[model samples]
Structures are given as structure tokens and as C-alpha cells.
Target: MKKIKCLGLVWLLASGLTGFAKDYPVSSAKELSALSLKPGDRVLMKAGEWKDQQLKFKGNGVKGRPIVLMAANAGKTVLNGNSTLDIDGSWLVVDGLSFANGRLDSGEVVNFSEKSFSCRLTNTSVIDYNSSDDKVDYTWVSLRGTHNRVDHCLLKGKNHQGVTMVVWLSEKPNYHQIDHNYFGPRPELGRNGGETIRIGTSTWSFHDSFTLVEENIFEHCDGEIEAVSVKSGRNIVRNNLFYECKATLTLRHGNHSEVIGNYFIGNGKPGTGGVRIIGEDHNVRDNYFQDLTGTGNSAAISVMAGLPNPILVSHWQVKNARITDNLILNCKEPFAIAAGYRKDRYLPALNTYFAKNIILSNVSPLKVYDEKVVVNFEDNLIFSTAFSGEKGRGFELRNEQLKKGSSGLFLRPGQADFKPFWESEQIGPGWFLDINKKFTIN
Candidate 1:
């Protein structure tokens, strides 16, 4: 076994870095963490391999200048947490490091406290080794902080899920941003793998809000994105790319959020689709779905009322939501939007808009499972489904046989603008889609 070396303090002090009160160079993660860190102190890990250790920080930093913890050189340093990194501080930054292959008895590798704010982890790579059972063996990064950003990183693993970033606002933590990352190719088999980014309301708090997930690449994971039971005021997920995954995105039991400007490709397995919506009001617009080919089952987009009866169907319901300005290409079945609460429960669709989208080269353009549900539809383009069983390019619901409403499947001129409806009011085009086509409203 190669022994790791601890660089001297003189080397770190002479490293010529400013904006800090003092600097500390650490050889081992345990030795580095044992020191008492203050508000303006900086800790630099020298170039070496660290193994089977947990690096923890329990310090405080002020608002203006944060305590900096980073690798000395870009690719020269490695933090091989054969265990994990538990962070319990505010305004700390970790950059330019590598986190690889660790055992997870607790199901988590990196855990953050709610009080940690404005922290950032960037330019890092997290790779996991294949286990005997072919699982990733741990959850990559577990979050519970506000205004924290994780960007420009590569996270790849097997068996367990990828990054499970959660917010516990009751503990005074909110506003997490996860952007510009790559996630894929878990070591495990079967579809038991979870999502790349799983955003859910923490059990500690009901006030989770203001989470932004964008510009990430998700490929070959069982489920790409899963947002479950988040009771927040504003959540934004946009401008992402999904390829060769089981499911693209699923939003369940959430209120007042926007899912737009995303690209979904090659998904559909049994109970999955490109985008699935259940619960409250949300804006699903300006997205692109293409080549969703698989054996199990898939749709471009599926919106259904939550489970009913004793389950207490989401009180707000799927109301005041807009689904427009999207393009669905080469799908097995394009749209599956249905109403009527699950299992004999009836729910009405109020102020819901499904308009100005383009569906091309699909077996059936639109498949409305239920008819009693009232949906406002207008100005959509459905190309070349005139000869198969339906006539005259219009919306087809409930297995291409039943048609409902006046604004059925038909080709229209341009897309609809859904920016005004978003909570954050910050809208942009998808990852690689044409921006000129996005701003032009029909």
C-alpha cells in the first residue's frame, strides 16, 4: 500500500494565495480536520491519495469571505474517501478534487447540515467502483443546505442512487442550486437504481423552497430525475439533457414549480415516460422529447391526478398549469394526459392549459385516457397521423379511438410563452435547442 504524504506549512504559506487570514496544509484528511478552523482560515490538501477516511468540518464562516477548503493543484490532488465527507459549517468551498469508490453502511457518502449556506463544490469528479452485487454502494452527495451550489462535476457510480440533494427549510435551509454536472452508468443491474438528482421535502421541514436544477447531463441511469412530495413555493428544473435512461423526469405531489426547456431522448419502460406529472399546479413547457424507444412502456408526457379516496388527493390539484411550446419527435405514443382521481375518485381540471406544442412522427399524437376531465387546449401541431385510424390531424385521446374537446390534434404556427407563469420568472432555452425558435410565440 502506498502511504500518503502531508505537505509542509511553509509550502502552503508560500503558495501565494490571498483573501485569507491564515493557511494550513494537511497530509491526511483526519489530521486536516482535527484543527480548529476559524472564519477566514484556508486549508489546502497537497497532492496525494487519501484512503478509507471521513473528512469532516464543523466550523463557522462569515458572509463576505468564506473558509476555503480546496485541492492544492487541479489534477495533482485526490481525496479518496474510502468512507465519506460530513460537512457542518457555513460558507465553505471545496473545489478541484476527486471523490472515488467508498463503502456506505449509512447509505450516504457526503452529508451536509441545514445551517451550511452559500457553500460550493465544483470542478470535481466522483467515481465508484463496481461491487460484487454490481451496485454503486452509496448515495453520492446528500444535501441539506441553502444557497449551495454543485457544478462542473462528474458523478458516476453503481448499485445505489447518485446525488440525493434534499432541503429541510424547517431547519432554516433552502435555495439549493445543482447545475452543469454529468451523471450515468451505475454498476448495478436491473431498474432498482434511483434518480440522478432526487429532490424531496425533508421530513424535518415543510417549508422547502427555491431549488434550481439545470444544465445537467443524465444518461443510462434507471431513473433520471425524481421529485417526490415537495411542499414548496418555488422550484425550478430546466435546460437538462436525458439520454438512454429508464425515465426522464417525474414530479409527484409538488406545488408551484416549473419544468421546462429540457430534452428527453430514448426513455419508456413499463411505468415510466419522458415526463410524468401528478399533484398540484406546474408549468411543463418548451421541452423536446425524441426517440423514446424501448420494450416496457413509454409516453412523451403523462399527467394524472393523484391517488384519491383516503389518500387525500393533493388539495390544490393540477390546476392553473400550462403545458405548451414543446416538441415531441419519433415517440411510440406521444401524450397521455388524464383526469379523474385514481380508483373511482373524480377530480376536475380547472384553468389548465395544453396548447401550442408540436408532436411529429408518432403512432398516435395525443392519448387522453379519460373524457370527463375538462382541459383547455389550443394551437398545436400533430403531423402525419391521418391514414392510421384517425382523420384530419387533430387530438386523439384514450387509445387513438376517443376524441375530446375542440382544440384536437392539429398543426399550428408557433409555440406558446409560459415564462410569466413560472415562480422564479427566469426562463431560458433547453440545453442545445435553438433559442430563436423558443422566443417566437405563435
Candidate 2:
């Protein structure tokens, strides 16, 4: 009877029928790599500063029973100085780890390998991780494969030449969700490759990413004019906040994408851009832009002219663009139509619709660089004290009174329950709430 009972317990463990999974406490990367974790198991790293640890956590876990690797203490376990992580399996979670004071000359700081799927990286912080040589390119986080999530983390102060985070694409669409993270200040890199987040690339621009980038806060991210560069088709960017970030959320090489319900607060800063539109079948709607001071390609909305017979990496012509229902206030040159209309690049936006937009600015609202573009403008209202004589084809000058709402944002009549953006306490790791007090509105 005793032998039979022991064999039954072994069978239950082997078959994963038991709810009790083992939790191993590891002190080093060597111990972590040696352990074979099963579904529902956990490997907790001991609390302290771990230096130069290259941790490769690979395992397979089933649905509803993901293998977890986390810090023993949420914010106390720090990985510094040349540390990196690679997650290379399905249904794995990496949580509550901090990477600080690290410099990787090349290679990513955290990589979800090509085989990884249904994995999550949450409540983590990568702070000031840079390469000593600013020209050396390396991504901070690289997400490969499908069905991955990166949420509630802080990616701050990436001053290198490469992107801060990237979503790699393949033949099939990668359905990744990137939400609720705090992307802190990144200074200007002066050249290309300073984007905070890039989804796909020019080589993979024709593929569908199907990625969702929502509810993130981008504060002071002045990295080469693109805060988030969307380079694939069929993606959505919604409800995010861009605060004083001398950059635009550019749809650089995508088609059929949507940018909706976002806030761009420029605070009258220099080189503060809003959105640059390209490609076909795109929608830009329901966004609020305030106090922006950029013009031309950095206007609140720039419908760019593309190159004649454009290549894969060149700017494509904007076609079938729907720009509607946006609130533009106190921005300089709010609409830049036919932007970048050079001699060689004169392919104008075709069959575009601009409607139902409310603009209240003291400056001139429209700057149509090209006269041959076919854009239908209707149901748009404009009220500018400096441009009361400004008359255009598609908009009427109406005196609409604006009032401050409960969220400290000025709004028009019949518009209620609107928020300016997320508070700093609402994003990032749970332990890093004090960052809210560090920022001041200009």
C-alpha cells in the first residue's frame, strides 16, 4: 500500500495534475540556468545587487500556469553593469527586476527570443542603460515572435544610437500589446535611430504587425523627432500622452493604421511636433494638441508629399487619409498640408478627408504648401483672434467659448469627462511612484 501511494504521488507530479508546484530560490545565474522549471513553478532571485549577470531564462509553460521568474524583493534586486536577460520560451513571466548603471556596447538588454510566445515583461525598470560610445547601436528591449506583452514598466534615459524598444516582425502578424509604461526623458540624438519605440522596419513595412500601443506616457522624450515610429500595417495607437517631447508619433512606413484619442501637450517648447502622416488608409482622430510650437514637418498634423515612384524605404504617398474630430488649441501652424513638397517629391495626398476638427489658435491655422493636392475639408471650425480674417475653403471662423474642465484641460461646449493624460503614479513600477513629483508643467 505504501509503495502504491508513493507511485501515485510521482505520477501526479509528472502529469502536472497536482496544484503544488515547487519554488526555487536561486542566488546566481548559474543556479537559475541549471533548474528545470515546470508549469506553475517559480524561480525567485535573491534580493541584492547582481552585477554583470547575463540571465537566459528558457522554459515551456502551459496556459493558466505560466512559469514565473521574479525578484525576491520587488525593487531591491538590482541587475547592474553589463547585465542582460533573454526569455526564450512560451508563457513565461519576468517581473519586478531592475536594471541600472549598465552599459552594453552591443546586444539588447532584454530580449524575447524568436521562439518566445505568450510571454510578459512587467513591473520592470531599465534606467539609464547606455553604451559608453553613443554611436554604438543596440536596442534595450527586443520583442520577437507573437502574443507578447510589455506593461507597467519604466524605460528611462536611453541616450544611445539605437531604438529604446523594438517589435520585430516576420511574415505573419505579431500581436503584441505595449501598454501603461512610463517612457521617461530621452535627449536628442541629432541623427536617426533615436526612436523610443519602433514597430517593424522599412524592410518589413508591408507586413501587418497588428500591434496595440496604448495608454503610455511619453515625457520629455526628444529623440530624433519620432517618439513612436510605426513601420508596419494595421496597427493602432490610442490614448497615449506625449508631454513636451520635441518629437512626433510618426506613421513612417505603415498603411491602414489608426492614431486615436491621444494628448500632445507641447507647452510652447521649441521643435515640439505632433504627428507626421504617410501611407494609405490611415485615420487620425479625437486627439488633443495644446501649445505646440513646431511647424512644417513638425506641425500638429503634417500630411506629407511623397517621392515620385517611391522605393521601399522612401516616403510613400498619403492616400485615403481620414483626419477628423480633433481639438487643436494654441498651436503654431496647426495643419501643414502637402508638407515636404520638394522638386523630386511632389506626389500629393490623394482623396484625403479632413472634417469635424475644432481649432482655436492665435496663429494661422493652415499652411498649404502645395496647391494641387486633393483634400476634401468639411464641418471644421476655427476661431483665431490673430487670424479672424483668415478664410479658407473647408473651415468656418466661429467664436466658440472654451472653459477649463475637471481635468484642468480647456474644452469646448458639450465635451465632458475628458482627461488630459495619465498621472505619473498611475504608470511605471509600483515602487516608483515618487517620480510624479519630479516633473513640472511649463
Candidate 3:
């Protein structure tokens, strides 16, 4: 009786009584759309170029059992030439696909719909997928909904205008995670709307995005001044590498965001900026800014002055900013206080605190635009080749010789043990091994 019962259970599982997951091999978009996918089901695309295909993958799966859409062979399936993907479901995963040699005439290349929750897009590549006309604006990736993630992807060569990736927010908080990706080589668009990543728009700036952007690399992404524009509240940008990118990660709107542990390596490039502050209660800490040449409003650290009684869409006064424990090495302008101050825009930063920072620069460390700006500095250190009895209210000058590390980074004595948090192997796809070959940390 026991042997007969065990055999009966096996037969029931095999005969689909237990709802076993299955894999469907699909060749065309029409074939893929015909199937109704369930949880733990996988739709595998054939390993070839799928051109001019508009794929809308819509399914609902519970937690721990996601519906997956992937290539039969990883990195071998390409969607090119007017191809786009719309993920409009919950707990879905899209992995190992490539979008190259293509341009979307309208809409985004990859869009997570407004109702897509707990969805993820991983190990994908969107390369050179731009419209031929630069004026025709279309985004590459549009992330919406809550708890969505875009990770381990390579997004590069976006020459046309529009954000490379955007996190669209609704009335509620969208907790998105954008990490471990490579954003590379977007040339100057010479206008606005060229940000590599924008969290929220001006209309949704007051909403709480709760987004986290970390462990990514921004290489030569000089589309506009703002590389990663934070326009929402309570977001975090941490542990990312900005490699020779001629732009600043601007907190353009919203409040109470944080920028932490990021490395900005300019390599003495022109117009290379670090971070720009324009909000309230934002914290910028534990970041390293090296070899940047941008000055004035594009300094390594800039705090913008606001307009009197500014509108919601305009610049707001930076209040209660905490800039702490940052390393500014060989930068042209280390700090720009009251950066955009003018006659019309005369409201300076208020109650800001700069504490425990290390500044090693050739020029003056601080550029105070207005005398009414209330900034408190405490326990900062300045390393200089010639001290000459330099003294300040909050800084101590030390004549120290800097030495270069094995990876061509100049460090002060006892600071040689500082290692980068994010590495090339930790970010991007495994097949793209040359992610950070140009900049290697010791």
C-alpha cells in the first residue's frame, strides 16, 4: 500500500496535477504573446537578432516565484531596430537581453508600467539605442511602480537627448533600486533633458521616491551638467564611481536626500564636477573628489543660493546641509558656497555645516559668494605643499607630501589603505569584463 501511494503521488506530479512549472521556447513576439505564463514559468527567446519587435510581457506572480523572460543563451539575443519592451506585471523578471543597433521612434525602449511592482530588469545591455535625429526625444528605460530594480546592465552611447534611465514617481513613494550598472559615453547634448539618470521630474519632486542608486559607474557620460539628477525626497546615492564624467550629481529639487561614499575621479578633465546641493537637510559625506577642474557653480562641492520666495519649480534655499568627512584632492575649486548667487537670486545657504573634511587643492578651498551666508566649519584639514602659516577658523594646514598609489591615485600618508567600495567585477554583466579597465583601484 505504501509503494502504491508513493507511485500515485509521482504520477500526479508528472501529469500536471501539482501545477509544475514549464519552460516555453519562443521564436517570435507573436508566439510569446500567445502563451499565458504562470509563476515559475520561463519564456526563453531564441539566440538571434529579433528586430522591430514590440514585446509586452504582462504577468502576475507571487513572491519567491517570479515569471521570467530571458534569452535561451545569455547575451546572445538582440532586440534591434524599433524594438521595445513593456513589463506590465508584478514579480516579473527580464534578464540577459540586449538592445542594440536600434532606436525607438516613440516611447521608451524598456518600460516598467505604472502598476508593475517588485519587477526586475537585470543583466541587460542597451547600447547605442538612440534615434538618428538628436531632437527626437525618447527615453531608454522608464522605471515605474514600487520596489522595482534595474541592475547589472550596460547602458551606453546615448547620443540623442532624453534621460538614459528615469524613475517615474506617482503620488506614493516608489522604492526603486538602480545599481551595479555601467553608464558610458554619452556626448554633450548642449541642452537640458540629457541626464544619465533622473529620479523624478519637477512635478513629482515633492513626493518621496525612496530610491537607492549605488555601486554603478558613470564613465564619460557628459550629456549635460547633471549626471544623476535627484529630484525627489529621501533618495540615496552611494558607493558609485563617476569616472571622467563631465557633470555633477545635482540634488536639483526635493529634500532630505543623501550622497555618500561616492568616488568622483576627473583625471584633471575640464568641466568635471562632483556634487551640487540645492535642497534642505541633505547630507553629503564620505565622498572622494579628485582631479576635477570645474569651478564656480560646477565645483567639487557646490551649494546654490536660492531666489527669494522661489516657486516650487525653481531653486530652493539649501538649508541645514551637512557636508562631512569628504576628501577633495587636487581639485580646482573644492567648495562653492552660495554658488548661483545674483541680485535676483540672493538667498544664501543657511545653517550649513562643513565638518571633518580633507582638502588638498592648489586654489583657495572655499569660495564664499555672499557675506550673509551662515555656514559653520569645524575640524577640517588642508594639506598643502607650502603652509606659509595658513590659518582658518575651522581648518589646520599641514605641509605634507603626497604619494601616488599603485593605481595612480595620490594619497596622503596613512591614507594608502583606503580602498574603493564598488569595483568593476561587482557591477555590470559578467560577459563585459572590461567595465572599468581605464580606472583601476589599488
Candidate 4:
């Protein structure tokens, strides 16, 4: 092992030139700790397994010249940190590594505590295979820092929860991005098993804001993808795939967030809904819901603004939200929304926009409560039928008046010509069945 103090500065300059790449091979974890890395310095970890070691780097890098710690080869390299990676520095990049078997009595495997600026962890795999206990080992990756990015990582474990990525306003870790990660298959026999990704403000009165989760895949999570309760705002979730999750996504109490371009499949367990929006000024659009079958209770989407019973007057105002351009198929029940104010306190009305969607194989397509709740619906296609002696139609809206027209019904191409029997409905597009395309959605 070669020890080089402040060698990061030299490597920083050499990183701009091709000659410096050969000299900066970080062969051991011990040498990685000794170097005072700066911006543009690239530390390459050789291909081998290094177990039960704690590697720490306490240095800062510039914006354009981030200090990078990546794999020397595209081969298998493991870091079995029996503790955690406490990232306390800024502007660092850790890429292309596999971290496993992190044994912490408590806390997260990767702890980003009280750091600022930005860090990127890409193309990494974190696996926890501890089957000895039935307790959740806190979070796999805890984000208490600002503007960090975790991308293209596979996080699998037998813990209570998968990821607790959060931000607090006072110690506010704002502008964080968690994208293209896979969170799934929590330990089957664990207690207190809950959300895959839990988002909330810090305990010390911190406000979280500007978080983005996109293009991720989540499966077999016992709880929802998100649990937000604080005054965080501007959170965006788009283009992700959810399967076998209890609740795909939920917004307890937040404002100005958006969920768009997502695929939700097989959510809602025995008695629940799929996507629950319980906040203010939220937007849900361009989503696809399919095959949500459980114990006789399922809704493609549910929105509830206010609190129920003992009713705090201001709790239920899920106001000024929009739901549009969605496709709901094979759902056990229709979609629903609820809004009301408490009698004790005076609250304002709730308004919504539901438009341009295709709903198939359900008893009802739209359902709402309270006459004062204004919901606008247009350009939606509804397909309903009764095979078991039940009266089913193309449209059903409960407790609310819906405006329907010819533009509202957008039948599929084959549906316009061929009416199949009740048992022969097509589940997906015809292009998926074509073998010559060389690609499929399955």
C-alpha cells in the first residue's frame, strides 16, 4: 500500500491529462483514506473483495471537478462495511461498486448526515442478507444531506424497511434526486415492516423541498413508496414501475407535488386503495393502472383531502388538484375522490380536474362524495359489462354529476369492429404479441 498525503491535488491536475490516469490507481482502502482528495481527482478501486473495513474521506471538491471514487475494472468488487459509510464531505462521486453485509446495531448502512453540496452514487448494489433478527435495520440509505443523487442502484434486503430518504428544513437537505433504483422483497418475517421510501422533514423543524424520484422499479414492498407528513413541497415522481406494493404512493400532508407517467400494477392488499393523494394542490397524470386484485377491495386511485371523524375543519381540503390522461384496466373497483370541510371550523371548497382517461372492466369508472366538491370530467372512455347477471354500462359516477359527450369515449381500434365475449378480452396491445418486433412489455 502506498501512502500519499494531499496527493489529490496532484491527481486533480493530472485528471485533465491522460498521463495522470495511470498513476492514480487506488489499490487498497487504506490508501484511499490517506489521500486528501480534491476536485478532478479520480480514485480507482481495484477488482477484489475488501471486507469489514471502514473507508472515510473528509474532503471537499469543486462543482465541475468532483472527486470520483470508481471501480478500476468493470468486474466484481465488494466492500463489506460491517458498519456504515458516513459521508460527511461534499461533491464526491462513488460509482460502480457493490456493497453488502453491512452490520450495524442501529442506523442506516449509508448515512449522509449533516453534509452539504452534492454527491452521486451510481451503478452500485447494496444488499443486506441478515436473517438472524426480525427487526428492520432502520434504512438502507439515509439521506440527511442536501442535493445528493442516487441513481441506477439495486437495493435488496431482509429488513423492515428499504430506504428512508428524507430532508429536514432546519437541517434542510433540499434538492435531492433518487432515480432508477430497485427497492424490493423485504424480509418475509420482519416486524414493523413499512414504507420502501419514507420522506419527511427533520425533527428539528426543518422543511424538505424539491425532491425528485423517477424511473425506478419497486416490488414486494410491504408499505407505500412514500409517507410524507411535513410541509415539504415540489416533490415529483414520474415514469416509475410499481408491482405488488401495498400502496404505490401516498401523500399524507404536502403541497404542490406531482405524480406522472407511472405504471402501478397489483397494488392494494386485502382492503386498501392504490394511489392515495391526501395533500393540497397535487397533480396526477399520464399513469397506467392494471391488475389490482385483492380481497374484494381495490380502487385505481383515491383522493381524500380532509380529516375524517372528530373532523379537524382544515384537514380535508385536498384542493386544486388535477388527474388526467390515465389508463385503468382490470381493476376490481372504480376510482374515487372525497372532499369536505368540518362543521366546527369554516373551510374553503375543493376543486379537481379529471380528464382524458380509459377505464376498462370495472363496475364504475368515477365516484365522488359531497355536492360542493367541483370535479370536471371530459374525454374519457369507459368500458363496463355484466357477465354474472349484474347491470354494467360504459359509464358510472356515484354521488356526483359527470358531463359526458362523444369525445369522452375513446374505444380501442379493435373494439370498434369486433366485440369479444366476456371471457375473451385482450389484456394488452396487439403489438406486444408480434414476435417480429423483438421487444415486449412483459
lDDT tens digits by residue: candidate 2, 1-442? 9999999999977766588778999988899999998989999999999999999899988788899999988977899989899999999999999999899988899999998999999999999998788999999999998999999899999998999999999988999999989999999999999999999999999999999999888999998988999999999999998989999999999799999998898988999989999999999999988889889899999999999888889999999999999999889979999998999989989999999999998877888899898789888888777664346777788876888776667676686755444752367788776644433444
> Which is the leading candidate under TM-score?
2
After the best TM-score superposition of candidate 3, give how far the Cα of residue 178 lies from its true spot, in angstroms.
0.5
Which candidate leads the pack in lDDT? 2
Give candidate 3 misplaced runs (Cα > 4 Å): 1-19, 385-392, 402-406, 410-418, 422-424, 438-442
In terms of TM-score, how similar is model 2 to the real structure?
0.94
Q: Residue 169, candidate 4: how far off, in angstroms?
A: 4.8
lDDT of 3 by residue, 1-442 (tens): 9999999999865443455789999988888899898888899999999999989898886677789999989899999989899999999999999999898777899999999999999999999998889988999999998999999999999999789999998999999999999898999999998999999998888889999999998999899999999999999999999998899999999999999989899988899999999989999998989989888778999999898887778889899999999989988889998988899988889899999998887778888888788788888898865333337778888777667765566664577544454533467876666775658433
Evaluate residue 32 in candidate 1 and report its C-alpha lDDT on the 0 to 100 scale: 74
Better of 3 and 4 by TM-score: 3
The TM-score between candidate 1 and the true structure equals 0.75
Model 1 residue 245 lDDT score: 65
**If ranked by TM-score, best first, what sequence of candidates would result?**
2, 3, 1, 4
Better of 2 and 3 by lDDT: 2
Total clashing pairs for each candidate:
14, 0, 0, 9
Model 4 Cα lDDT, one tens digit per residue, 70-182: 77764266777564455667887777777767555566666665664598777777676342454545666776678888876777664544344444444453788887676
lDDT of 1 by residue, 232-307 (tens): 5467888876655665476555567788888776634333347766556688898877666531124677666533
| Candidate 1 vs 3: which has more lDDT | 3
TM-score of each: 0.75, 0.94, 0.93, 0.73
- What local lDDT does model 2 show for residue 351? 92
- In candidate 4 the C-alpha lDDT for residue 244 amounts to 58
Q: Clashing residue pairs, candidate 3?
A: none
Ranking by lDDT, best first? 2, 3, 1, 4
Worst 10 residues of 1 by lDDT: 433-442
> lDDT of each structure?
0.60, 0.89, 0.88, 0.58
